[model samples]
Target chain A: MLLIALALLQTTPVAVAAAEEPIAPYAQSNANAGAKPFESDGMWRAFHGREGVDRIVDGLVERSLVDPRISDTFKGHDMVRLRRVLKEQFCHLLGGGCAYSGRTMKDSHKDMGLQTADMGALVENLQAEMNEEGVPFFAQNRLLAKLAPMKRDVVER
Target chain B: MRIFLIMLAALVASPAAASDWRGDGKLVLTDGITTVEGAAGGGIATWAVIAGNETERGVGATAHASHVALPDFDLEAYGGAVGLFDRVELSYTRQSFDTRGLGAALGLGRGFTFQQDVFGAKVKLFGDAVWDQDRVLPQVSIGVQHKRANRGAVIAAVGGADDQGTDYYVSATKLFLAQSLLVSGTVRLTEANQLGLLGHGGDKGDDHTAQFEGSAAVLLTRKLAVGGEFRTKPDRLSFAQEDDAYDVFAAWSVHRHVTLTAAYADLGDIATVKNQRGLFVQLQAGF
Candidate 1:
């Protein structure tokens, strides 16, 4: 009976999680998103809800990947995980009812040797994507206001 | 000394190679418009912001011209400024005040012009006005302006004592991105009359007095801002009472390299003319 049980266990395969490349173990919280969520759903609606925000995040990442100003910073990093966390972060900040599961801005950008120009480049890319979604200029600033403060932690140099 | 010169050149050129330090990088209009005094700020008030679009790693330059047409006078200023690594700013401006018909009334002949040259320097001390949105700290800087006027005889005839003087100031500026608002305040010490156009010192007194300049603006869009400013002046001239100045202005970023500002300005009094209010326009270009 024991030998038969051992053979069955050996044949069973270990599950590969669909969450993408693993990160080191750390506690996750929505607070890791940095700023507090908008007090109302107007912001979320302005962003066209979940689908819109996800597209914006993916679009920003894609643009940054090709942007020579900051492309090297993204090289060799797990973009799949980055896209996922960034979406979570934007959704939560926009009041889309999503929880963030990522490291602090300082931790995530650590050792990147990023500069102010790099931060400026990332902001421009994000702005272009937001504009692509037809977000109004005023509402665009509302989101930018929330993200601008993160520059303190995002730019190490 | 030759080796040191080579090292200095490398120190500056290596960064240029690394970052391509130029324009089109800073957020729109964060550089502010050129002040009439030639510093980088509002049309009338000085802020703690550097002069150009350069970040912490680059060099930037700006040139500007401004005009104010009053009921009895015309004021014009033209100048340029440079920002080094967003750290130090050096500037120069030539200003001319046309007394118009008032010149004849004051016995200085018709269309008499009071010319002055202002040389200014500023250095950033601490904080990041734009990026420190999460912190209460504001960017601060100290500056000095050496002003020399051309109409020494006219100034002395009007009870003035000197044709040249220096003004010192410390400024603080803060930007609240969430509210799309920017505010700046400056405290200046000087003995000049009429912004050093008439001259320095007076029969009233030659002691340097503290003056205040304050401004607040709302960001209407990425390329537009509307604001108001108030500046207090010293009542230095015994021959004519001097008053404060104020303005309400609109600044538009028409392109990456151009900014145009229009204002309703009030200079209070000039020489003997009272309620000197009028239209003011300025254009600035930067890289």
Candidate 2:
């Protein structure tokens, strides 16, 4: 009787494992499928309503225009269109109800001769802008963390 | 020495003219405290991070004073370092080792002192400890230190072959920003006895041997870090058994220009003194 009970216990876990394993992936896929698009969140609304992101984009453009290290990269570019595209890109990244229609990070920065120092300057400017916009440090870090993966695509030199 | 002074002058002069210096400005606690040998690292190890606030385009310098008091001995060191373009570091340090009880035991009278000057240079090989977060690579550097001891007569009497020698090392440092952790490892090829205070190459052997040093730290805040370090030493002198050194240290970056560090160090045996342990304190100021 003891042996039979032991055998049942061993088989029961296997049965339970089989039953539980499939549901996890299924639930994960369902969650991914049901994820809301970026435009519906309160955080996104707050960010866009205050024009916080626009201010940040404006700050970046202004700094880059004068920065000796990176000013030449923007000499021939269209400033007004670039500003709009940057706003759209930042808004999309921050979960605002917008989609980015501009070039991918790699394509946009390709052949730009961007060095690590240039990237560092851009980040420094963005951080200053975030501080000026009264964004909390944690929030600033969150945005940086999200954007950090783009370094591989953006840095060519 | 004249070149070092000129470099120091350059370091002190540059920050005054360039007020817009950027490029991370030395990540918090990533610039390890200056070591006794005048390298940027923990108590006894050399880390891969560059010495000062200098980034890719600017220059920075730091001056440090350190004191270590043991049961039978005491050590005092003063030094300064300059970093250029965050790529190369040049440092000069002078150390005074006071053999109190051990000197008397050796019949050399009490409070005998051994002094040495160390000139060091380090070059960054690759990677950035602070910003290369998305990857597993750590910052790596290679360094060399030329040491010349002052008490050549005493050193020669104690079985040392030379009063001067050089040590070479390679170091790697990594930081996990999310976890607030920093780690570093160094391998040195050295023949120094008592860090070249008692001089280099002894009766036991004269060939340089590889030694290991490592450090791990957890950041308590943006500017404070508490860590421990372990450094293995070569036992080249037959008269005394050299043992590994260890320290538990706390470093605080009080401001952009100053950092204070304190530690409890166990330097093992020095000149037949067993289990020599004591307090270590250092102050660093830089641009």
Candidate 3:
């Protein structure tokens, strides 16, 4: 069921982009949708081999930091909400998109004190998660820098 | 239960030799390269080399205890480090400098001694402080050390200050994993001259000077790392000329949960003193 949903998502942006135009060359038809999915897959392969992202996310969720309540937070919403958020965060950060409409950084951590100790704990948790996912250090660093600035806001002590 | 306990012991002491394992040495004092591991003096207490960033963010910690025995004197110290992140590190240490019979040689009463408590933190700014394959420049970091002199009179008599000031520094390190080599250098600016609080104000001029420090490490095999460092200090006190210090070290990983590093150190000057030779050791453990 998840695979079908992912496949549908994988094809949506391309189909939409194609539908907006008149019939073009069959060769151009595949190219017009852009090459982001392939590139994302390449990054996934470099750090975590086949199905790496799934393995990583699985380990991350098991760490208990993400909160099982997270699923409940968006449970009633359609799969589109989950996919859109992931695409915007991961895809845009990876250079594929220019827009991200998630909650403001401060809003995301409003209730949490997120002290120095907490941040340390989070970093350790993520390191373990990435290690389990086989993410390389350089690659992880690049991804982490995107969130580094938030340290100032997230950590109160 | 016996079998389970043995298995647990094996797991606890298992040697972890992976390039990425951060818990292979003393935890608290060693940051990626320039600060002490939050812990102190299980060995090599007289230098400015911090741990690599790779271990800073992981769960690894370093704990050590040291004893310096000489014909006329003996000393002891303890400390360790817990790496909060690859970017930030925190450390603490306490040292007891026993005068013993040596106090009489210096015209002081026997058992006259000094004690020091130090706390430190270092944060990496730019570049990878440990592994940077795409660039030749080593990783860069900045940190500060705050020391409190328990014996204010002992420290002040030698021209030291009552309140030990914070010492600031910036360091860069490069690890050539493919070649099994590591090199690091650091520059520090501080009011406390020498490792001692003894030199509060420079008798010569400005209170601060650029201290050049460097370290080199070579891996003889998968489980062994041999290294050394040289650092130059400024002459700030009229009473004594500060000399440089050097140390040679060898670290062996017996298992994933345990690694031990041993070093021979020479701290150039203490109260116009010469050639202080001692041994340094560190034990580290973590996931």
Candidate 4:
């Protein structure tokens, strides 16, 4: 049944277009529908301005502090510095051209005995922050896809 | 039952004590429960999602028990599956089919049962079901199931060609995260008769034929999903006609490690018993 529906949609150009339509809640218009996510620094910068970036990081840190699953890992850390480095790292990865000045993922996470669960918790917190900031799902996914490879470096167990 | 409890206890206890479990790295309501064949999927159809919460860097395993009670028949299955690197999956399932009064009528003796074993493996070909929101392409997987029926003589007497066979399938699954919708389509080529319990092939058709299976699910909450599935079947027996199967199900993730699913299944005509409708329930524990 799903295959038949998909085939039908594919045969009808208008239906296919409608199916491919973006459902971004924060999208002002469909003007960027044809634009690829993370294709250019301009797109990244426009999707989340400096203020949006700051808010996203702030949201992430706030959520992490209360998330029992990973809160222990954050103990005794300087949240202010951590937040600044995270913002810079995300900006750099998203093509904002803000060079990351923090330690490499492996070096920073080494000896911390970070587990896959901790990485998962952090990702969830980041996702929630993205949601709060009204970041487009596509944009968030693109960013995540870039950061996903770091799992090898961050997770020791 | 004791084994099931032991497995569930181990899954929960070990994960909690060691903290080695992957947790919620996989998307919520995305890692579906083990299907009857032990693959991750809906009631009757297989999806392309990998099993458990292995993600792309770790290993995860799940144990499941399912029961399907029909008007004239009942099926009980238990199995476990393991996902490696969120790419390959291997599973094993044991099924016991009770024909109830139908067994007596068929002269196989009252309360006679037929048992079968299924071994399955699947590999993800490409795409990401959860994170590929920017593209229309869905995750695709290719899989195979090898089935062996214990009652070879009975199957041969019923005009079955072989007591063992293999089924091959290709499945594609997609998740529209923002819309909280999931859709999957699978095409299987098989010559199995009654899912290989009645054996493979038959006098009517001794060759493999393509069958369709599909599912659509909606996430009502982070931990709850409601879905429906349709699976076409092969009519291989000359004695009785077989029809398609379908189910409407709701699954709840009670915790990161446990899921419970309940469904209303319409298996159409199985053997000569028409309208074999019933309730299906499955419990899965994983990490």
Candidate 5:
């Protein structure tokens, strides 16, 4: 009888172990019809799908009044370089990840003939625009910190 | 060695010792409001015309008093200033010029007194001395005053004609912090021989006498300042040869809105007259 019982247990294929198997709650939804694997973990999927970059880019285009020649030059030449400049400046100023990769500040403004009064006007314009965009004063000052040092380079007069 | 001692003696002496004139400070240009009385020393004279830098963009008010240290005469004066939005400053002053023994010489009463009132206004023009750290042109200001001689008969009888008119001028004030001093100078086109209402009146000339006014205030502590002022006057009116005015003064900022100023004043040449001494005390409050 013991021999017969052992044979039956082996054929039953570990019923206790089979009953204890863990079931994934989201497995069915994740497997359904080309669903992304990352969606299995809802947090990462939400971050990857966010539209932060697009909103900031649209804001820049709408608010900034670029010089016609400068805008045309940016549009005609390497879009990648122009995009990088915009992203880098905005990200650096607004406290984002991108590092500024451009000409040394002094080299960039070598022939600009910028004066203190001109700088002041620019600052005033920027402040007004930032205010319209609901940027807080504290954040504005933080952005100014990144640009103020360049005054020595930008202001030739 | 002798020159060094002379310089050392000059610093320790009283009025007319050393003439180290300077401006208030670079930071003072935010508004027309300025420290009351001289920035330092305990002698007597009103301080700078304006209060703060143009950046402050606020109104300011100040009052100052001082006494003169002339030979035998004594004088006392009270003055106040009102600055509007860093653009304009209107000032009013009342001065009492007393003659001790001089009154006897003039055949007046045993103790005669001359009094006057001054009304002043200042407007700013282009300059970067207040805001730009790298600029040399001090913030330039244009000012004018209507002098109304109070003792008309007394002044006319003593000095010939009591000229009452407007005294207009321009002033530039700059502060050199690295040197711990302030420098200011003014040019006035006027007929008044002296600042006194009893002196020669205004409507004097268009040539504008280049009267240099300067102050050297040492920053003893951040809140305490000690200094003196030397101002040259135009005696274009035949009544008197303008005697230079000088004072030793001290000022204290008790709080952000309040300041107390005290000084010993020596207003020179009252209608060809010299050596008028007096005491001045002033209280200034601002919003």
Candidate 6:
């Protein structure tokens, strides 16, 4: 029964950007997500599949936009595309069966001049959003474990 | 002159925290709480964590007051530490041990107190313990603690060889986030007896010997962790056997800037008093 519900969640429509600004062309691959997916679907079910990943991404991006420490970093960026790709990236990393259509972490963060503090602030926001979704602390850490290494790529400064 | 010194210190510190001064950027408790010896770590064992809320680009500080109440003795430590760029750490701690009524039994006057000071420095070599989850390497650091004991007469009477000595150590620490676990191991070379509270070296052995501090913690939440630590000691003075120490501890970050630690410590034996178990508590304010 739980598996059936999780499968149904995968089909639930997640919000996509109506339009995205075109940028310099780059190759897209699941590899661009910067982390490999979990081997078992247990992680996907733990995340409540697509619906949970969508909410977490939307919530994280929304929180980061207003967060004083990291707000300046998000200004003038394509938030719509950011939200969509974040969902994809999260879904893929969580083994939710979604293809990541984003650029590599280093390339996308190019010239952003992000500092370690910015990455820390963003991580704090992500933790908050994940907590708001009632994810177990252990499961939250599993996801964070995957995302943590990306700090090297995402924070260039 | 005082104002000039303060300004000079501020000027020296400002260059490292290039990230706009407010160094409260690292995740909560990642900076670690102050150990009894004034280094960032668990209750008793010094870890590889830098003592600050800063990460790679900021300067921060930590201060702590710790107390341990043993059956026949009581110990107190109060100190502060400065963290530079989350890379280098300097700390100072003053430790005082009160013998209570037991002092008179050893032919010393009542309430004989032993006081000592520990000045410590640690430098991180490499690896990000908290961040490098994809890798197997743990964060490593090397440190030195120069301890000075004040009761020279008592130390000499007990056959202790030196009143002051230096301890050298290297530590490795890692957080297995996926497992909600944190582990640390430290190897120290020292001739200190009873953590240098009884002075350094001894008639039995004046040479430095290798000791170990090992600990493991379960990360319960973002701000709470419970752990256990075991530390080996050098049995320097034959007058009284110096034994190992162990503790089970819980550390909670009540706020981002304040932490409280409580522990049940078995210090084994001290000054011929056997089974020196007690309650250990610490309050830390940082960054």
The per-prediction i-RMS, to one decimal, reads 1.9, 4.2, 9.3, 5.5, 11.7, 1.2
Candidate that scores best on lDDT: 6
Task: Give the residue spans of candidate 5 off by over 4 A.
Answer: A1-157, B1-56, B69-71, B201-210, B236-241, B263-281
In the range B31-150, model 5's lDDT, one tens digit per residue, is 222322212112322223454211223444444554553576666655655554455666666566677777887777666876666667777675533333345667677877777766
- Which residue pairs collide in model 1, if any? none
Instruction: Compose the digit string of candidate 6's lDDT tens values, residues B171-253.
Output: 99999989989999999999999989888899898999999998899989888999999999999899999889999999999
Kindly list the per-residue Cα lDDT of model 4 for residues A1-157, writing each as its tens digit. Answer: 9589446534543333344323224322222112222446863564476657777886788789999878889886666557766777776666676656566677667788887557767878897888777776656655666555566677786
lDDT of 1 by residue, A1-157 (tens): 9588445433321222264787799889887888999979999999999778876887898899999878999987987688778988989999899899999998999999887878878888988998888887778878888888888888876
Weakest 10 consecutive residues of candidate 6 chain A by summed lDDT: A8-17
Residue pairs in candidate 6 whose N, alpha carbon or C atoms collide under 3 angstroms:
none
DockQ leaderboard ranking: 6, 1, 4, 2, 3, 5
Q: Write down the lDDT that model 2 would get.
A: 0.78
DockQ of 4: 0.12
Residue-level error in angstroms, candidate 1, position A48: 2.5
**C-alpha TM-score for every candidate:** 0.88, 0.72, 0.54, 0.72, 0.51, 0.93
Complex DockQ per candidate: 0.34, 0.08, 0.03, 0.12, 0.02, 0.66
For each model in turn, which proportion of the native inter-chain contacts is also found? 0.39, 0.04, 0.00, 0.16, 0.00, 0.75
**lDDT per residue, candidate 1, B1-287, as tens digits?**
24324433543443356445634457878889988898998988999999877788787777788999999999999877877788998888889999888889878899999999998999999988887777888899999999999999988888888999999999999988878899999999988899999888899999899999999999987789999999998888888899999999999999878999999999997887889999999998876
How do all the candidates rank in terms of TM-score, highest first?
Answer: 6, 1, 2, 4, 3, 5
Q: 1 or 6: which has the higher DockQ?
A: 6
Best by TM-score: 6
Off by over 4 Å in 1: A1-19, B1-22
Lowest lDDT 10-mer window, candidate 1 chain A? A8-17
Candidate 1 interface RMSD, angstroms, 1 decimal? 1.9
**Candidates 1 and 5, the one with greater DockQ:** 1
Model 3, span B1-287: residue lDDT tens: 24324333433443353333433322211232222323211133223334322333243334445555433445565555544445554566566677786677666678877666667776667765333443576677777777765667655566554446666788776656435566777787766665543534554544666777677777554456778877777676677777787788776766644556667777665665556677655555433
Residue-by-residue lDDT tens digits, candidate 4, B191-255:
98888899999999899999999999987656789999999989988888888999999999988
Residue A107's C-alpha lDDT in candidate 4? 62
- In model 3, the runs with Cα more than 4 Å from the true position are A1-157, B1-60, B67-75, B197-199, B202-206, B285-287
Sorted by lDDT (best first), the order is: 6, 1, 4, 2, 3, 5
User: Where does candidate 4 clash, by residue pair?
Assistant: none
